[model samples]
Target: MTKPKALLIDVTKCIGCMACYYACKEANKLPETEKVEEDLSATNYTVVKETDGVFYRKLCMHCNEPTCASVCPVKAFEKTPEGPVIYHDKKCIGCRYCIQACPFDVPAYEWKSNKPLVKKCTMCAQRQKEGKITACAEACPTGATYFGDREELLAEARKRIQENPGQYINHIYGEKEVGGTSVLIISSIPFEKFGFRADLIEKPLSDLTWEIMSKIPNYVVVSGVFLYGIYWIINRRMELSEYNKSKNRDSSEDKN
Candidate 1:
């Protein structure tokens, strides 16, 4: 039930179309960005970037073990069972910890607002609840961004990889990055050429961090007891020395 909803993006199929970007803007009813070409603003949850004849649909990765949820002190962000990381604006305290913690740098603050919620892709949770698809998925003419269960998407990715190894890099970009992502990417060229990040740890960032944190409480209790024992022993030694001195003084008085 902890499993989050995810989107599967096949960049090889994507044309440098801004339909998805415009769809997201219209759906969210966000303010326009300063750029006349494209609105890439805090309110804009989606953006398109083109380079060297390659195009990518960039937005929140929606990590499986979201760092935003873990680091948020006020519990503003939540990971839904369906697979999207949803931010509760009312709960947000304007703290930027989530922005810093996310490896994908997905959370965008509304600098224009006095109280801004961290914003990112919600995987169209509302649309899914209503039996509809996301704005981007609906708007995509080439079907680059597919909307469905994560398992089905991954299977489709594997099928593509097996069917044509030469055509694809043979890796699902989000299959298991940062503990697995709801949004998966498959590209024709090396992912790096598509502006994909090359360096990612084998384990999700949380697994490595949680493993150490899980041991901390036990260590603290054990260390506290050990220190307490040392203090008791030192006090006992002082008491014993003082008792011996009293007895020696009594003997000297008797001899006198």
Candidate 2:
């Protein structure tokens, strides 16, 4: 569908001011955590993560086959045709399974009260539907973040890496991870050094887990093995019992 996507984040310009976070909360009209300045709530869709000298803007990865969508028991999370993975709070049962299943750790739990909702970036779905840029992109002062088609973004990322080998970390974080995410990341320091979870696999995070438990003939294999073992044990016991009975009969006969 030539669906619109986003550029890989270049962390070079992010100064960790968190103007984007404030813009997001204001745009969404979300309440503050009030305990610390960084209290992420059900409404705070996008936030920032920082490490020694690098900063990351954490939000939904908008994965190709999102694990959150796949794991939602009632399907509260949905991937839009336009490429944004959006959440429907009304259908949500307040179950946080999506939080646990997400490898990127984007979704945040709203544990403050009853009727709390799990929240993460929607890729600014409402604005996109209305033909506008994402709030964070628009609010960014450094022109650091951008939005576009996923394919085009990856190409741009590659081009940048090729043009300036020493400038970037030479890795595009989300281009192929999780079956190709709509949101991409380009970093300055290595992503792991910047507090990104590097342990997540490149596959759709749910695929392997779902496969071993849901598909193939593992159950049949296990059942066959169990039955075979039981049968072997029973047969051995029967043979031993018969031998002992025969010995007793032979002894009695001999005695008589």
Highest TM-score against the true fold, candidate: 1
Report how far residue 233 has shifted in candidate 1, in Å. 1.1
| Pairs in steric clash, model 1 | 4-82, 4-83, 5-82, 5-83
What TM-score against the true fold does each predicted structure earn?
Answer: 0.91, 0.78
Q: What is the C-alpha lDDT profile of model 2 across 158-214, one tens digit per residue?
A: 998889889888789987787778878887788887556777777887787788868
Residue-level lDDT of model 1, residues 125-221, one tens digit each, is: 7887787788899999998988888998999989988898887888899888777888999888777775567787757786777888899999999
Q: How many backbone clashes does candidate 1 have?
A: 4
Off by over 4 Å in 2: 32-36, 213-256
Worst 10 residues of 1 by lDDT: 32-41
Kindly give the stretch of ten consecutive residues in candidate 2 with the minimal lDDT sum: 34-43
Question: What is the overall TM-score of model 2 with all chains considered together?
Answer: 0.78
